[model samples]
Target: MGVATTWHGTTILGVLRDGVVAVAGDGQVTAGDVVLKHRARKIRPLFDGHVVAGFAGAVADALTLFDKFEQHLKAWDGDLRRAAVELAREWRTDRYLRRLEAQLLVGDPGQLLLLSGEGDVIEPDDGVAAIGTGGPYAAAAARALLRHTGLTAPQIARAAMQVAADLCIYTNDQVTLITVPPERQEYEADDR
Candidate 1:
């Protein structure tokens, strides 16, 4: 079943595999039955391109969260998990932020996380997650692809977003993607 979205139409998903992580989003903005815009980018690179993030909700609110999250990233010295957690805590406890209806999928080469206004910071067990109107379908498609095929992280993310667009009326095929590739030094013991 498709989830209900009042006016914000979006589908955002991410996948992590073999040291590669990617996030993808569909660009469709709707107001009830009306399609307002197409090609509205929802996926973006953050922290000097070290992290990637996607969002689903009111565009204004999502932008606000993005700015706040960026500050958290700076404060944490680019720690993805810590930045996400701080953002979640603020989103949940700050009354003004609590009223913002949005969800974030963020990651680096080594991790993928989901943050919500409910003070939740989640790391999917399978290194795949989704949010927005077509989130479930996209998530399921990514999981299936991950289990049955050897698609690269970006390929899997893009394909799953396409499936979501086909199934979710709120989503469209105009997809954008951002990825982080593995570096050899990241695997070194001293690097960790």
Candidate 2:
């Protein structure tokens, strides 16, 4: 709110399959035509490990929204849908929050949702969601993998992020993934 934060360049993807959910994010940040950071983490657990969220946009703005959403989660008693909806509503209508340039992909074991400043809280029909520069590619890849491959949710998420990193200039192979329906554990692809 004090100073406008720079836009964060990266990719984040989420997948839900067979009662499990996984989220992955690339670790690259760029400014203008120059790369700034190579290991920024964009996905995190919230509400006492019940929900996982990945964000794309200004890092400060995203963190602010994340903190607010955490409060919403607490207020809603860890209800993912309610917390997401309330965050979206506030982001859409609140004077300051409406200016945040960020999009959120949040989920639990059974649900994946996308929240935006436009007051949209969407549940992906195919249990796949993505945000950031490489979002479309990752989402499409995950959808295809879900439809045609026997990969688990975590596998699909990691693969999709890898696919995104290959195609999107802003995205990279330094991916961080987390799975739900079991306890959260971090997974990284090859570390290249």
Candidate 3:
């Protein structure tokens, strides 16, 4: 959206295992066959709070959605699960949204949420979900991390970043992570 327009890809991933979650993305973004940029953070902090989101195309669109989603959440004092579901529902039925140019993966302190217009507010009981470049790889890594260690929020985020790092999927500055611990998750971003 600035000096760099490298935020498209086909390898973003996320995983949920043993009640823990980890999501990862590659550093490379492609527009058709051309790599547009590197080290972009597909995974991002939403509402500047505990909820996190990641996407794999049309960076601007994804960001716009996040902004509106966050505002809706705040406006209603909404729960993550319900808010996510509502957003997905809207995205799915709205005439204009029916053609969103990107895919979105959203998560918060209490649960992991994925919205693809296939369904909304889906809380994966299996403990995992993901979207974007290097997604499969990240999902695999998350499963491995979950199996080996019943990770906490920070641990999950760290694991996701580690997996993305190995694939040269992210840049040093582009990767960032945060978490919301169960009860304290709701006001996560604004807690400080």
The numbered model that scores best in lDDT is 2
TM-score of each: 0.90, 0.92, 0.71
The C-alpha local distance difference test score for the whole of candidate 3 amounts to 0.58
Once fitted onto the true fold, the runs of candidate 2 whose alpha carbons sit more than 4 angstroms away are 1-8, 187-192
* Full-model lDDT, candidate 2: 0.88
For the record, the alpha-carbon RMSD of candidate 3 to the native fold, in angstroms, is 6.0
Clashes of each: 0, 0, 18
RMSD to the native, candidate 2? 3.5
Best by TM-score: 2
> On residues 62-132, what C-alpha lDDT tens digit does candidate 2 reach at each position?
99999999999999998999999999998999999999988888999879999999999999889999999
**Please, what are the lDDT tens digits per residue for candidate 1 over residues 1-192?**
987757968899999998889888888889889998777888777998898888988878988999999999999999999999999999999989999988999999889999999999999999999999999999999999999999988889889988999999999988877788533211101100
- Ordered list by lDDT, greatest first: 2, 1, 3
